[model samples]
Target: MANKKSTKTPAKAKKSDKKPGLIARGKAYMASVRSEMKRVVWPTKNELVNYTVAVCASLIVVGVSIAVLDLVISEGLVLFASLRG
Candidate 1:
C-alpha cells in the first residue's frame, strides 16, 4: 500500500472541524425550534375540549373492562381454592 499525502495537517483539520460555541449552538437550535413551532397546526379550544373528553371516555371504558376481568378472575380463583379445601 502506498502512503497517501494529506493536504491539511492534523492540527489544521481539527481547527476547521471545531464546533460552534455552546451559546451559538443554543441560539441556532432555539431559532430552528421557533420556526418549527410556527408551522404547527394547533388545536382550537373547542377541539381541545372535545379531544380531552374523548380520551377520558376511552380511558374509563378500558379501565372498567380491565377492572371487571380482574375481579372475575380473582373471585374464580378464590372459589376454586375453597372447593379444593
Candidate 2:
C-alpha cells in the first residue's frame, strides 16, 4: 500500500495569503495598542517628577562630559601641531 500526501492547505495559510486593508490594519493596530495601554502600570505624579529630574541630570552630566573630552582632545592636537612646527 502507498501512502498518499494530504492535499488540503491549513485554514491559517488561506487567510494569511490575503492581508487586511490599510484602514483595517490600522484599526486593528490601534485596538491592540489600546488593549496594551489598559494593562500598563502608570507612574504616580511624584514618580514622574523624579524620573524627569533624573533624566535631566543625566543629560547635563553627559553633555558636560562630552564637552570636556572635546576640549581636551582639541587642545592636545593643537599642542602636538605646535611642537611639530
Candidate 3:
C-alpha cells in the first residue's frame, strides 16, 4: 500500500482596498480626543494658583541656595589657589 500526501490550496486575498480620506479621519480622531478630554478631572482655579505659587517659591529658594553654595566653593578654591602660588 502506497501513502498519498494531501495538498492544501492557498487562501484568497481580500477585495476591499478603499481607505477613508485624511480630513474625515482627522475630524473623527479629534472628536474622540475631545470626548476623552471632557472625562478628565481638572483642578480648581484656586488650587492651580496655589500650586503655581508654591512651585515658584520652591524654585527661588533652590536657586538662591545653589548660588550661595557656588560662591562659597569658588571663593574657597580661589583662596587655596592663591596660597599655593
Candidate 4:
C-alpha cells in the first residue's frame, strides 16, 4: 500500500490559522451593521401610515372570509348529523 501523508499542521502554522476572538468578531459585526443602516431608505410618515392601513384592511377581509367559511362548514356538519339520526 502507498504511504499516507500527515494531515496535522505545525504548531506555528496552527496559531496563524486561528480566527479573531469573540470580542473582536462582535465589534466587526456591529461596525458592518452601522454602515449598512446608513444606506437604508426609511419610509416617510405618510407612507408608513398607508402601509399599515393596507395591511390592517387585508387582515380584516381575510378574517371575515375565514369566519364565513367556518360558519358554512359547521352548519353543513350539523345538517348532515341531523339527517343521519
- Measured against the true structure, the TM-scores of the candidates, in listed sequence, are 0.78, 0.67, 0.72, 0.78
After superposition of all CA atoms, the RMSD between model 3 and the true structure is 3.5
Q: What lDDT tens digits, residue by residue, belong to model 4 across residues 1-85? A: 6999889885664457679999999999999999999999999999999999999999999999999999999989989888645
Question: Per TM-score, what order, best first?
Answer: 4, 1, 3, 2
Model 3, span 6-81: residue lDDT tens: 6877787785776778998999999999999999999999999999999999999999999999999998999988
User: TM-score of predicted model 1?
Assistant: 0.78
lDDT of each: 0.93, 0.93, 0.92, 0.93
Model 2 Cα lDDT, one tens digit per residue, 46-83 = 99999999999999999999999999999899898896
Candidate 1's displacement at residue 57, Å, is: 0.4
Q: What is the lDDT of residue 47 in candidate 3?
A: 95
lDDT measured at residue 6 in model 3 versus the true structure, 0 to 100? 62
Best of the candidates, TM-score: 4
Q: Against the true structure, candidate 4 has what lDDT? A: 0.93
Worst 10 residues of 1 by lDDT: 9-18
Give the Å shift of residue 2 in candidate 4.
20
RMSD of 2: 4.7
